[model samples]
Target chain A: MASGIAFGVVYLVYQPFNAWITEVFKGPALPVTIVTFIFCIVVSLLTPPSTHTEEERVALVMAERNQEKTASVR
Target chain B: MVSGQYAVLFVIGFFVYIGLMILIAYMTSKKGTTQGEDYLMGGRNVGLLLLICTAAATAVGTGTSVGATANGFRDGWLGAVYPLANAIGLVTVAFCFSHVRKHKFRTLCEELQFYYDGSPYMRKFMSVVIFIVSIVWVGSAINGGANYLAYLIGMDMIPAKIITVLAFGVYVFVGGYMAVVWTDAIQAVLLFGGFVTIAILAIPAAGGFDNIRAAYEAAGNPGAMTAFGVGSKGVLGVLAVALASYYGAMAGPTAHMRVYTAKSPQTARKAILIAAAVVGCFSILPAIVGMSGFTIASNTGAESVLANPDFTFAYMATTVFPPAIGLVCLIAGLSAIMSSADSDAIAGVTTFLTDVYALIFKKPVEDKDIPKYSRIILVIMLVGAFGMTIFANDIMSYINNVIGSFTPGMAVALLVGRFWKRTT
Candidate 1:
C-alpha cells in the first residue's frame, strides 16, 4: 500500500512537473509519453517479490509437520 | 471497377480465415482441461513462435495500420511513429517477460495483488478497474472488424456488425486461448503478405520509390523522409517521447497476458523480441501505402480524406493498384482487423472470467464453468462493441485516446512491481 501511495504522489508530481522533467533529466525532454514510459520502468523495478524464499517456505512446512508428529507422539 | 475484384478477395480471405480457425480449434482441443486457465492462458504453455505472432497480431491491429495510413495521408510519413512506439513496447516486454511470468500467477491482477496484499481492498479495486478496461478494449476491436466489412463489401453496417459480433463469439467461445493464438499466427502472416504486396505494387504505381520520395518533397512534407516524420510539430522530439511511451505501455494487458501464457519466461521474452522486430519491420508497408495515396491524390487531385484514417490505406489499394493486387490489399487489411479483434475478444473475456468472476467471487468457479462463462461474457462484450461501432464515426480518435489514457498508469504499476521487489 505504501507503494500505491507513493505512486499516487508521483502521479500528481509528474503531472505538474512533467514539462520540467525531460529538461532536468539527461536525454530527451519529458514529453508525456517518455515520462510515462520511464515512470513504468522505474516502478516495475521497485515491485517486491511475490513468492517466499524456497528455504523459508520449506522450513515453515517442515516445522508444522514436526509439531504435528510431536503432538501425536505425546 | 475494383469492386468485383475486392469481392473475390473478401470471399477468399473469409473462407481462408474460417478454415484456419477450425483447424486450430481441432488441433489444440485435445490439449486437455479446457478450463479458465488453459483456455484463456493457453494452459501457460505458449511457445516462442505462437507468442510472437499473437502479440504482434493483437497489438498491430487495424487501428495501428489504418490510423498510420491516415496519418501518412494527412501528415506524410509521420504516421509511422505509432508503430515505432508499439515496437518499443514489444521489446520492453521481451526483457520484462521472464520476471513477470516467474510468479506463476494466472492474471495480471494477481501480480498486482501479490505486491499490494497489505491492502486487500486495493487489490480488489484494481482488479475491477483492469477488468473494465479489458472489456472496453473489445469495443475498438469489434469496431475495427465492422469498419473493415463496411469498406470491403459496401454492405450496410448492420450485417457487418452481426458478422463481427457472432464471428468473435463463435470462434473465441469454442477455441479460447489456443484458438486465439494459433489463428492470430496464421492471420499475422496473411496480414503481412497483404500489406507487403500492396506496398510493392504501390511503389511502381507511384512511379517507384524515387517518385514517391519526390512527391513528399513536392508537398513540402520533407520531414516524411526522416525517421521522425510521423509527428508534425515535434518530429525527433516526438519520436523519443513515443519510444519511451511505447516502452512503458508495451506490455499492456494483451502483451502482458501473453507473458503468462508462454511456455516459459524465456519463451515469453524471445517472443516479445521477435514481435518487436516484426512490428517495426512491417510498419513501413502502410506508410508506403499512405504515400501512394498522397501521390495518387496529387496527380488526380482527389479529396479522399474522410472522417477516418483507415480509409487512406483502403482507398490507395483499391484505387491505385491493379485489381488483383488491390484485392490482396483488402485481404491484408481484413486479416489485420480480424486477427486483432479475435485475440482481443478472447483476452478480454478471459480477464473478465479470471479477474472478476473467479477472484471477486472468492470461490472456485468449477473448471467446467470457465468456457461457459467465457462465451457468455464474450457475447455480451461483442454486443456492447456493436453499439460502440455504430456510434464511433472517428474510430481512430477513440483508439489513440484510449491507449493514451489507460496504459501509462498500468505501466507505472508494472515498473514498481517488477523492479522493487515490493511483493517480498
Candidate 2:
C-alpha cells in the first residue's frame, strides 16, 4: 500500500515522460492503446505469484518427520 | 424534443435497471440460506473477473465523469490525475490484502477494534466515527444520483433526489449485497460502454491531434501540452495535488472494504491490479470529454463548460451525440450514480448492524439476522442521507472535505497495524 502511495507521490515528479509519450504518438488511437495493453500484460506477468515451491514443500515435510521422530523417542 | 418524453424514458430506464437488479439478487443468492458473510462478502468466492469488474465499476462512477471532468476542464490534466491516485491507493490495499484476509476478519471496523484493544473505548469511538464517515460519503453519492436525474429529466432537484434515494433504497433493501455487486457489474459495463464510445467519437470531435494542439494554443495554456503547468506554484503545490488525490483514494471506505470481502488474497490482488489498469484507462475519459467540450465550445458560446464544469460531460453528450446515444449516456451516468450510492449504502449499513451493533451490544450476532436488519438500517440511513443531501452544498467539495478530515488518520493507523513490528 505504501508502495502505491509512494508511487503517486513520485509520479508528480516523473509524469513528464507520460506527457512526452502522449505527444510523441500525437494522439493516434491504435498505437497508444495497443502499447498500454501490452505493457499491462507484461506487468501482470511480472507480478509475483503467491504459491509455494517444491523445495519449500520438501523442507516442511522433513521438519514434520523430524518432529514425529523426536516425539517417538520422547 | 419534448420534456415528457425524457421523463418517460427515464422512468422506463429506472424500472428496467431495477428489474435487472432483482433478477441478479434472486439468481446469485444461495438457495434459501445466507449467512452474514454470504450476504456481505458473496461467500468469499468472488473470482478475479467479478472482483475486477466490481472494483472498476465502483471507482469509475458519475462523480468521475462529472466532477473529475469539470476539474479537468478547469485545471487541465491534474484533475484527471486523481483517479491515478486512487489506483495507487488500491495497489496499497492490495499489498495489505494477504495480512488482512489471513486474519479472517469480516470488516475494517472489526480490524480496527481488534488492533486497538488496548483501549476498548477508543475502538468503539472509532467504529462510530467510521460509520458516520461512511454515511456521509454515501449521502453525497445519493445526492449525485438526484442531481443527475434532475439535470437529465429537467425536473426539480428535490423530487429527483427523493426518487433516487427511494429507488436505490428499495432495490438495495430487497436485494442485499448480491444485488449491489451484480447491479454494479451491469452498471460498470454501461458506464464503460458510454464513456469509451464517447471518447472514441471525441477523438474526432477534438479534431484529432492537430485540432487538440491548436485548441491548446488557442486557450493560451502551453503548459497544458507539457507536463509542468503554471499552477505548480512550487514543490509544495505540486505535491499537494498528488497528496490530495492519494488521500482521497485512501479515504474511500468502499474500496477498502472490498479487500476483505474478496474470496482470496490472490483474487483481491488480481482485482486491484486489474482495477489499476482499467481505471487508468477510464481516468482519461473525463479529460477527453472536458477537452472536447473546451474545443467545441471555443467558438459556440457554450459558457456552460466554464459556468458548471460538473455538467461538461452531459453537455458534450447531448450536444455532440445523436438523441439515442445521448439518452444512453444519460442512463449511463445514472448507472454510475446509483451503483456507487447503493453499494456504499449496503456496506455502511452492514458495518453498522453487524460490526457496530454486535460490538456495542456484546452479543454473538447470528448470520441469519444480518440481511434483515441490514435492510432496515439501510432504509433509516438512506432517509437520514436524503435529508442531508437536500441541504448540502457542492457534493464533490463536501466529499473531498470529508476525505481530507478522516482519511489521513485512518491510513496512518491501518498502515502501522499492517507493517509495523509492534503489531506483528
Candidate 3:
C-alpha cells in the first residue's frame, strides 16, 4: 500500500524521484508488486499467525474427500 | 465498384453474425436454467469441450487481435511471448488450482475468502480490484473492437463503439454464462481458423517471408524479424513486458470463472491444459499477421495502417483477403474481441453484485433478481467502458500499460494468499 502510493502515486510522478526510480527499477509497476509481495511475507512474519491455520488444513482435506465422494457417487 | 460491392457484403455479413450470436443467446435462455448457479456459472456442469472452448476463446481475445498485432508491428516476435506466457498461466492453473472447482467457488473473491481462512478484508479488497480490472479490460476490448470496426466500415467512432458493446452485451444480458460459453465455443473455432487463415494468406500477400525480411531490412528495422525481440527491445524490456502479462493471466477472473463452471476438478484441469496447448500452438500467428501488415503499410504507405498499427489485423483482413474470405476473417477477429469482452463484462457484473452491492444493500440479491440486476449493471459497466474507449486512439497503450499498472497488485496478493499460509 505504501509503496503503491509512494511509487505509483507519488514518486513516479515527480521528476527527480521518477528519474531516479527509472535509473534503478526501470519501470515501477512490476518491481513494486514484488515489493508488495515481500511486504506480505515480511509483515506476516512480524505479526502473529492466524489461529485458523489448522482448521484451514482440515478444510482442504475435507474438500478433497468431498470431491472423491462426489466422483464416486456420480 | 469492386471494393464498394465487397464493403456492402462486409456490412451484411457483420449484421448476420451479430444477429446469430443474439439468437443463440435467446435459444440457450429458453432451454437452460437461467437462474441461480446456472446464470452465474453455467449450472456448474460445464464439460471438457465447453470449458476448453470458453477458456481458449476468452484468453485469445483483444490482446491477440489488436494489442499483440500492434506489438508485433512495433516489436516483432515479442508479441508471441504474450500468448506463450498466457499458456503457462493456463497450464499452471490446470496443475495447481483446477481443484478449486471442487470448492464450487463463484468469484475469485470467494476463492480468496476460502484461501485466507475466511478473512473478509482480502476478499473485499479483491472485489474492488477485480471490478476495476474487469471494467478496464472491457474498456480495452471495446476500444480495440471499435477501432477495428471504424477502420474497416468507415464509420464514426462513437457509433462503432456502441455496436461493439451491443455485439457482446445483448447476448450476455439475455443468456448469462451458458450463452457466453456456447457462443464462445463456436467462436473459438472461427477465431482460430480465421487467424491461421489470415496468417497463411498474409505471408504470400505481403510478397512472401523473404520479401518481408527484405522490406524490413530495407526499411531499417531488421530487428523486427528477430526471434526474441532482443534486437528491437532490449532483454530487460522483453522480460518486463512478459512479466506484466503473465501474472495477470494466472489470476485472471474470467479463467477462474471457467474453472468454477467446469463439471469437476479433473474436467477443469483437462480443459485448461488443452486450452493452453491450443493457445500455445497459435501464439505466433499474430506476429505473422502483424508483421505482414507492417510490410504492406511500409511498402504502400497505407495512411490508416501507418497511423494506427492497432488496426493491422483489420487492414490485413479487409484489404488483403478476397471479399468472402475477408468477411469471414473479420468476423473471426470480432469473435476474438467479443469473446473476452462478454466474459469480462459478466465477471465484473458478478463481482459488483456479490461484493459491493451486497455490502451496501445489506442482503444478498434474491436469486430471481440476479439476471435483472446483472442486466442493469452490465449496461452501466459497458457505458462506462465506452467512455474510456472513445478518447483512446491506441488500444495497446491504454489496455496494456494502463491495465498493467493496476492488475499486478491483486494478482500477487492472490498468488501469495493461496500459496503462502501467512496471508493474514
Candidate 4:
C-alpha cells in the first residue's frame, strides 16, 4: 500500500499537474503504483527471503495445489 | 416536495426502518454472540447469500452510492465507473486471495507476518495504520450519511452525524458482526430497490431519456451523455478513479475481515464473485439516478442542487418521489453508508482488541473480556471518527483521501510479500 500512501502524500503536497497532465496520467498514482511495485521486487531480489519464507511458500503452494486437485477429483 | 413539509414523515420512516434492521440482527444472532469468533466473524459460518449481500453492501457503501450519485450528477454515465471498479476489485480478491481462508488469519498483519516468514517489523508498523484506516473509513461513512440527511431533513450536520453514527452503532454493539451481515442483507435489498425505483421513476419525471441527453448538452456538458466522460475527466481520469478504487478495495480492513469471516475458501471466492456481478448491475441505477437528478436540476434551476450536487440524491428523492416512497428511499441511501460504516467499525474494534491492544500490552485479551473490550473500543473509535466527519468537506474527497493515504503501502506490501519469496 506504499503506492497509495506515496500518491496521497504527493496529492496532498500539491496540485502539480495542469488539466492536461491530470487527464493524461491521473496525477502520478499510476506511475507511482507501477514504480513502487517494481521497486519492491528489485529490492526483494537483492535480499534473501525472510526466515522460513521459502518453507512457507512451499506449504502455501502445496495447500493451493491440493485444494485444486481435491476439487477436480470430486 | 419541500423538505420541511416531510420532516416528520422522514424521521418516523427512518426510525422504523432502523428498527427493522435491528430486528433482523436480533433474529439472526444467537444469545448476542458472546464468543470472540461469533462476535467478530459471526462464527465464521456466514452462508453464501449473507456473504454476497454483506460484501456487495460493503463494497457499495458511501463511495459507490452517495458519492457515485453525486458523480453521476456532473459526469453522466461515468458514475457507473465507481461500481465498475468495485466489481473488478471483488473479482480480483476472489481469484488472487481465495486461498487465504485456509490459513484462518485473524488480521491482515498476521498474514503479512506469515508472508514475510514470521517477520514482526511490518506487522507491528502496519497495525496502527490499519486501525487508523478503519477510523478514517468510518469517518467518511458518517460524513456520507450526514450529507444526505442534512439535505433531506434540513437538519444541522452535527445532529445528522450523531444520528447516522448512533443508528448503526447501537445494533452493531448488541449483535456484533452477525448484526452487521444481517443488516447488510436488509440494506442490500433496500439500497438496490431504492436506487432502481428512483431510476425508473425519475426518467419519466424528467420527461425521458432523450430529454436527459438534451438537457445535458444544453447545459454545455456534452460529455455528460457519454460513458467515457469526454470533458475534464476523460478516459484516463476514469481509469484513475478505478485504480484508486481497486487499491482501496484490495486492502480495505473491513474487506479483509469479511474475507476471513467466510466459511471456506470456495465460499469466500464464490461470494465475492457473486458480489461483483451484483454490483456490476447496480452500477447502472446510479448512472440513471444521477442523470435524472441533473435533468431536474437543469430544468428547475434549483440553486441548492446546482451549488451542492452531493445532495442531489436526497434532493431528487424528497422532491421527485411520493412521500412514503421517498422516505424509504432516503433511509436506503443512509443504509448504503451505514452498511460500510458498521462493518468497518466492528472490524477496526476487533483488530484493535485482538491485534493492537494485545501487541501493546503483551498478552492476549481474556476470552471472557473480548466482548466488553470490543464494545468499548468501538465506542471510542466511533466517537473519534465522528469528530473527524464534522470537518470533512465531502464524502468522495474524504473517502479518497483517507483510503488513498493509508492503503497503498499495505496493499503493495501484501502483494509483494505473499507472492514473492526474497523479501527478508
RMSD of candidates 1 onward, in order: 6.3, 11.1, 5.0, 5.4
lDDT of 4 by residue, B149-248 (tens): 7777677989988988888988887788889998999998888888888888989998999999998889888887876464637777787777777777
TM-score of chain A of 2: 0.29
Which of candidates 1 and 3 reaches a greater lDDT? 3
Off by over 4 Å in 3: A1-6, A15-29, A53-74, B1-3, B388-402
* Greater-DockQ candidate between 1 and 2: 1
In model 1, the runs with Cα more than 4 Å from the true position are: A1-74, B30-36, B117-119, B240-249, B306-308, B358-360, B391-403, B422-424
TM-score of 3: 0.90
Can you write out model 2's per-residue Cα lDDT over B297-359, one digit (the tens) per residue? 775778756667787777777777776777777777777777778767876876686557756
Q: Candidate 3 at B221: error in angstroms? A: 2.7
The better candidate by lDDT, 2 or 3, is: 3
> How would you order the candidates by lDDT, starting with the best?
3, 4, 1, 2
TM-score of 4: 0.90
- Taken over the whole model, the C-alpha lDDT of each candidate is 0.65, 0.62, 0.78, 0.77
- List where candidate 4 sits over 4 angstroms from the true fold: A1-4, A14-24, A53-74, B230-232, B390-402
Chain A TM-scores, per candidate, are 0.27, 0.29, 0.50, 0.44
- Residue B140's lDDT in candidate 1: 64
Q: Write the per-residue lDDT of candidate 3 for residues A1-74, one digit (tens) a residue.
A: 33333445444347786677566655555676877777777877897776565445336333332222212221
DockQ of candidate 3 compared with the true complex: 0.20
The best candidate in terms of DockQ = 4
